[model samples]
Target: MADPSNYTYPSPLEGYEGLEPLPDEKETEGPNAKAFINPPSKTLSKAYNQFADPITNDTRGGFDIHIYYLQTNASELKFAAELHERIRREFPELRIYRLFEGPVGPHPIAMFEVNVFTPQQFGAFVAWLVINRGPLSVLVHPNTGDDVRDHSQRATWMGQPIPLQIGFLKEMLKRKEQEGQTNGS
Candidate 1:
């Protein structure tokens, strides 16, 4: 029989050992060190939860919970409708948009959008969906001005990751950039 106690694990930092250590607080005395230590503070309109800050923006800080379902499946459609209704009833204060049967705007699948303002509301709503969501994929993202980053980098999934319409998003971004150029010219 093999001895379990004799088993050894590989080191986590096995490859990189040549990297220089970050300057210690005590070592930081000059202007450069001070600049590194105390970086410029971002001007935020309101204080937001640290966990949700990456996703949240200074101007329009909120979350968009998208419940995705297959439109071809009748059962899924019905369930999605019911789920939408339940969410509306439960969170009356939330700005819940109409249940879309087809891909709307940047969404790749048939989904509904739920807008939440505060971190508390977002936490509660997500928790509820985590427990109740069945046979549905959810795309939870924050409105942080940058549409590309919001959909791709800062996105969270409740179920399997359904690929977003990145092409559409990129095209829109390109158009916006062109418009800005034209306006500036």
Candidate 2:
């Protein structure tokens, strides 16, 4: 073994062994140099195709944001209605579904669904909801062609998360897979 005290230490910048030295201005400015590379296109990022997942082909911002409230609570019901109206008035571009008075699908409480097709839309709506949503629970999940996983594992929540009855979703997927196999055979 080499003696630690006698061994030569490599320079901290040894990895830049053959790289060109920095420009005179950059060297003089040190870390304060205003160096940045602008994107090729005018827009910073792609508007339509954002999500890149190998499991599913839904790359074009396929996501469902469900805002939930208890129908039994009159105040909550009223707030949800007003919230729905406000969302429609503010963001008419979003595909906002009608308010369900009762539990629908896997949701254990009354909720309304809004669909966002772009990263910008998702970001903006979520930000807006974060400020505006009062006493409401929101469930945001991607549509990766796997309903059970989307609702359970990949789901994002705002406020207190309500338990989802995903057993039905699992059953539905199982049925679909069986049907596909039967047809293929």
lDDT of each: 0.78, 0.79
List, residue by residue over 59-97, the lDDT tens digit for candidate 2.
334789999999999999999999999999999998899
Which regions in candidate 1 have their CA more than 4 angstroms from the true location? Answer: 1-61, 180-185
lDDT of 2 at 49: 52
Best by lDDT: 2
> Residue pairs in steric clash, candidate 2?
none
Model 1 per-residue lDDT at 87: 93
- lDDT per residue (tens digit) for residues 1-185 in model 1: 12335445466566647756655454256656545443334664244443344455343448888999999899999999999999999999888889898987778789998888787788799999998889999988888776777787768899988888877888988998999999995
Candidate 2 Cα errors over 4 Å, as ranges: 1-49, 54-61, 178-185
Clashes of 2: 0
